[model samples]
Target: MNKTFKIYAVIFIIIMVILALLEVSKKEVTDWRKNFDVNEKSPFGLFVFNKEIKDLFKNNFTKIDVTPYDYYSEKNKKPHNILVVESEVDQESWNKILDEVSKGSDAMIIATRIPKNISDSIGFYNSKISFEEQNVLKLTDKKYQNDFIELDKFPSGRGFSYIKPNVQVLGKTVEKNNEDQANFIKATFGKGNIYVHCEPLFLTNYYLLKSGNVKYAQSIFSYLGDKETIWFVESNTKESSSLLRFILANPALKYAWWVFLGGIVLFIFFNVKRKQRIVPIIEPLKNTSADFVKSIGNLYLQEGDFHDMMAKKAQYFLNKVRLDLLIDTQNLDEEFSKKLQLKTGKSAELVNEAISLIKKAQDPYAGVMKEDLGRMNKLLDGILK
Candidate 1:
């Protein structure tokens, strides 16, 4: 009972030790998971940070609505007095928007980098201009004044320029550290006016809150008055994921079952070869094999086998005792029994009785009863343990 209690206590302590170690671990957000939920409109994107223009327009403007356009869904909207387009505008979508504006509707497009055709018309590549054109802009608070319209800037031809000859230039390619400063032009198309901004960052939440670009937003809003304003927010949506990008990112396509079969065939032809070798056998020296015998005996004992099982086990142990003590069958008396009992730590009477039973037991092969085997096993284990 005490041995069993110790075994259980050791097992329980091991389990508790493992549990205590496990309690020290903590999990954090991975880069992939963090980047997953980040969208263009997310707080991390330009939408959350730029506040100067948004605040100015939101309070003064009576009717304000926003629509997102991709390659599709850029057509067939009621004409408005003011239009704003940011981000990538598909060729077809912009053409449709231009068509609407041609019908006397006003618009403002802020592109850090204008498209090739539009940029060409505005002489974007001309060396006469003092600045490089790009699509994204970065503006500092010092660069922007109460009159300045801030825009976001990035490298490459991502700055603003004017394609329309009739458009009135607000701020030309100014000699400054800010790459975003470009031809902020206002053009008259038919009966309506169009404002083409080089940078859209002024409208973003970040610039709105930091700089006084809110004044420019208020000016744009005041020009349009209470007229319904349409803000076209472009998104890639369904057409955003390119097939080439998909194929590159997903390598599983290269290792499909058919592909794997083809790879196996190539490998077999180029690399695999059959070879012959000899295997050697090792013979082990004999050692005391009591552990193997005890394991097999324990299995049989746990199965509750009766009759011959107990008699066989008792005979096996009795033979070992006889060999160790050199006891002869004819002279197996009290002195021999006492010597065997002293060697095995068994009671003298029990050892004698167990030996007698092993020698005189009925043949288990001749249908010996299970109850008699049980009684014999009880006696044997009592002496052995």
Candidate 2:
């Protein structure tokens, strides 16, 4: 049994060591999952175009950073071009964007999924298009027909379907199967136009670096036309603090945080001592004198030593009389009874009865019965009361 236990313990230790090494050596991959956050440094982020796009607008327009709530506010209502990129747009933000665009501010949205209100307002709906093999994209305009543009990595992106008659197709996906799907469209709102692009990954860093793909991205920008001022709406989000972000980014630190929380729980479970009251050391009340006399009388009765029990009772009664009444108990005559009656304020009959019982109890050869003992107890009780 001991050998088997040792082998199991060794195996556990080796497994733990391997897991710890893996945890330590594991590197966090650059998250290429498309978030479209312009501030993020990931490959799918828009950090590379931050300088170039801002410089592009520097000569003709001023760049401003705003949120959906801020841009819709009354105090900041300037007619400028709006750019938004998100994974999923909510109804409220979509409505606000439509309202802003209807007021003659051109808006361009690059997202995987657009909300129902925005899609309905633009007269188009988006659907997922999956390519079993690699595919390339082509602009529907004749001017960009020869441009080489390929979306080789992202096999699953979005495409526009059920486009209304009023909407114009801007670009389409070119697959070897000849299954060309519309992915970009331009629709007219109240006074301004809304350009909806289904594939936002085309603007990401990975595809932007592809050969001759920059021209494809640049062609999509031309739809904005001469509306110079640009308002980039940052997604409304609760960003994590620097320390928390670091802990989440590192696996070892995240594990250490969990271990620390577990230690706290264990400490509270083991160390939350319950406060208890101090127990008092109470000495049992010293056996009362009356109880002691009753116990001795019971012992004498058990042994059938009634004469001795009577003698002890008489002696104790006389002693109590002498101490409490300050009267002599040497004699048991009429004179003694009278003195006891006067001192204790007892009736003469009660005092005489007690004296007579004491005299009977003092006789050495007297035979005491249960009736005689009960009568003596009654007489003594009357006198004492």
Best by lDDT: 2
Residue 335 in candidate 1 has what lDDT? 73
User: Can you write out model 1's per-residue Cα lDDT over 1-385, one digit (the tens) per residue?
Assistant: 4685467557655765564456435453323111111123432244442333345456433222223334225445555654543456656656655566677666666654556665453334322233443332222233333455433342223334334454455544443455434446666665566666554444554445555555655554454535555555433322246665566445454224334555566456544455746768778776658788889878876886555575676666666656765655444567767776786788767888866666546355545456666666677767656
Residue pairs in clash, model 2: none
Per-model CA lDDT versus the true structure: 0.51, 0.73
Q: Positional deviation of 17 in candidate 2, in angstroms?
A: 7.0
Predicted structure with the largest TM-score when compared to the true one: 2
Report the C-alpha lDDT of model 2 over 291-384, residue by residue, as the tens digit: 9889976887789876777787899889988888788889787788788878778888777777877888999977778787888888887777
- Poorly placed runs, candidate 2 (over 4 Å): 1-20, 27-32, 50-52, 59-70, 146-148, 228-239, 247-385
Poorest stretch of ten by lDDT in candidate 1: 30-39
Model 1 deviation from native, Cα RMSD in Å: 33.2
State each model's C-alpha RMSD to the native: 33.2, 31.2
**Which stretches of candidate 1 lie above 4 Å from their native place?**
1-44, 48-78, 118-145, 149-165, 172-181, 235-385
